[model samples]
Target: MKKTLLTLCSVLCCAVLFAQVPATEKQALLDLYVDTQGDQWINTWDLNEAVADWHGVTVENDHVVSISLLFNNLNGKLPASLGNLSKLRILELSFNKLNGEIPAQLGQLSNLEVLALNANGLSGTIPETLGALSKLKQLHMSSNKLTGTVPASLGNLTAVEVFNVFDNDLKGSLPAELASNNNLRELMIAENDFVNTEIFSVVLLSNSGSGLNLKSPSLSPQAKTIIAIESPEDGN
Candidate 1:
């Protein structure tokens, strides 16, 4: 009876194996979701299991376009080699313990659309090279330890949508060039020390000018635990 049960179990296992997706297909799925994160914070990405099963991240497909990993508890600095993903269209790395400056190499991704790095422990000034991305749409870098003025060259982004940098230690005035952008929907600069951002037409201008600080005013849902975490209050 024991031998018969073992044989039955073996046959069932084999059947399940044949029904599993091909190795290449599995790799593709993992690669697509390798950096997926959601609205929740505090959960860091530990890809040890994925790495162990597949051995490494594969961003080789030139057709591959988007990669989002926001709100994942991925601590530590980003791997510089990621700059090699030239065909990448979207990249989001917000709300983590990632420190250090934004890699200038990221500017090389000419097709990049969205880039968010908010609510982290990051520092250093924004990279000027980011201005080079022609296809960039949304750019979020708020609620971190980032300092220095907003990148003046960011004015070059004509296709940008959301450009938020609130609740940080950033200083200096908003560059007048940003006002010229025609495609931007939101321009958030609240809870910091922004001087002005009277540029462009913003659908949501939540807190553009003063009264911004590291521990400044409490905009609803700004703390992350709230359900509907929308834009900050517009001081416009």
Candidate 2:
């Protein structure tokens, strides 16, 4: 009976140790904590505690999966180590004070689905590597100071549903490849310096309820035609 009890205790201890995420993933989380000034976060993590006890971090089967830290007072640039969470699905860090260019390493997160970085102070052009997120659904980077053309490579997001880059300083013509995604439902690219808006006319015409919000100073006649078609009530 004594030997059996000792065996059971050892098994329990092993299970407890295994319950924690891998060292690489845990280090990634720690990098995020340190990079984003976790000490200043409204809900800070206690390094002494298990990773499962960390706020906004979700672990499953000892793998870090999702992190939802929206409006959490994260005041620094995102760490490149975030890509180390290979199983990560949703990364919601919007409404924070994070700035600096988005790490192109984020494109390494092949399992990423929802990436919400809106309502922040992030600058620099959207990383072209983001087009590698084949499984991404809702991408929100609006209300930032982003510049340059929308990466034509973003058209590779065949599974994307909502793409919102509204109220930024992005310029250049909208890529026709972007309109080819059949899964796209909500496209908000307003208040920018985009030219050659006619590329989206067919998209606007075919997907009437796709919720496209384009407002540029130089709208082509075809763009105006689609705009008129989208808002018939405005004609009155």
Candidate 3:
């Protein structure tokens, strides 16, 4: 009986110890991400290793689990190998001076939940490959130089809740498939040159309250509904 009890205790300890994040791995990755920015400083923002002190990046076993690096002076291109941290759940890199188009390789993080890259200087189109992230819940890529129409593939994120891309230079109409995003709550697409819109989902403030002429027959239902709410005078 004594021997059996000791074995059971050992097993339990191992299980708990192997759980999300080994301290060394977490610190290593955190150090790498912060140090990636080196000593770059823009405006009032500056990237410092000390900033990682307030971050909550941790690793499970050998995998990074969560990393929230908001408002850091992280200037430079994102590493192409970032998807290697497969266990990430929340990745918030908003309010940074990061440049370059978002790598399509980032779409490989299937476990990701919240991805916020809004209000930055990121340029390029949203990758259609991001539709593969089945577990993603919140995605905000608003306020950037992101050209091209919104990717219809984003409709695959059925779990998505809050989606916004207001105040950008994105052209083309919203896709009808986006209406399938029933879990959507706050869909902000105001202040853009987007045309040929349709609305069949979501709630929004009437930026113009209907006066749109969606020239595209393929306008998504959600886009049409958004246009319907906008008055003609507000469509400028």
Candidate 4:
């Protein structure tokens, strides 16, 4: 009788601890799992288990808040349903084999802070809608096949600190509005084909002491001079 009572108490405790997220949030996660080929992931989730027990998932107040699956061999494209996780803050899926253009719906994640999707096979332009992430801080999309110019709308990310887009095929002038963002710290926009590079000297100069990696051959001599003046250690 004591053994049965103890088992029941344990079950009740586990139930409370693994309280599920809302149906929509749960479904969104499920969509990601399916779209990303979860079966092939380095750390796969067991759907039969509680949402809180899922690998790389963090839940709070019955809402999915964060998902960090970096270098997890996540194959396939990111599901658009991910935007449904309204309370989600961090979405890190770097160094994966995932392909396809980033879904614009991700911009709907208003509460998002860190958006790391680097070192993948992703292509296409960075979505203009991403500028809507008012709370965003770290935006990493480096080492991919992304093209097109950096969206001017991204300058709206006043809370952004580290904006990295290195090792892509992006061109055009760096958005002037980015210069106005006082919170920006690290700006890595190298290994691309951006024109009118001299205009971004201010942006590059500001992040000189930070982890600024602007060594593109396309940079004008004037920009190089600014880099040398601001970050003498780089010896541009």
On TM-score, the leading prediction is: 2
**Rank order by lDDT, top first?**
4, 2, 3, 1
Comparison by TM-score, 1 against 4, better one: 4
Q: Tens-digit lDDT track for model 3 on 64-168?
A: 767656666777776656666677787777777777888787798889988877677888888888888889887777667888878888878888876667657
In the range 1-236, model 4's lDDT, one tens digit per residue, is 99999999999998788788999899998998898889998899999999989999998888899998988898888888888999999998888998999999999999999898888999999999999999999888878999999999998999987777877889887777775677876666767777655555343433234543445445554444333122211311
Q: Which stretches of candidate 3 lie over 4 Å from their true place?
A: 1-36, 39-54, 205-236
Task: Score candidate 4 by TM-score against the native.
Answer: 0.82
What lDDT tens digits, residue by residue, belong to model 1 across residues 48-74? 433223222223332335555554565
Q: What does the lDDT read for residue 34 in candidate 4?
A: 90
Pairs of residues at least 3 apart in sequence or in different chains that clash in candidate 1: 43-73, 44-73, 179-199, 179-200, 191-212, 191-213, 192-212, 206-234, 207-234, 207-235
lDDT of each: 0.60, 0.80, 0.64, 0.80
Q: In angstroms, how far off is 62's CA in candidate 4?
A: 1.0
TM-score of each: 0.63, 0.83, 0.68, 0.82
**What is the Cα-based TM-score of model 1?**
0.63
lDDT of 2 by residue, 1-236 (tens): 99999999999998977588999999999999999899999999999989988999998888988998987999989999998889999998888999999999999999999888878899999998999999999787878889999998788888987777777899987667766677776566776777755565432321234544555554555554332122211210
Which ten-residue region of model 1 has the weakest summed lDDT?
227-236
User: How much does candidate 2 score in TM-score?
Assistant: 0.83
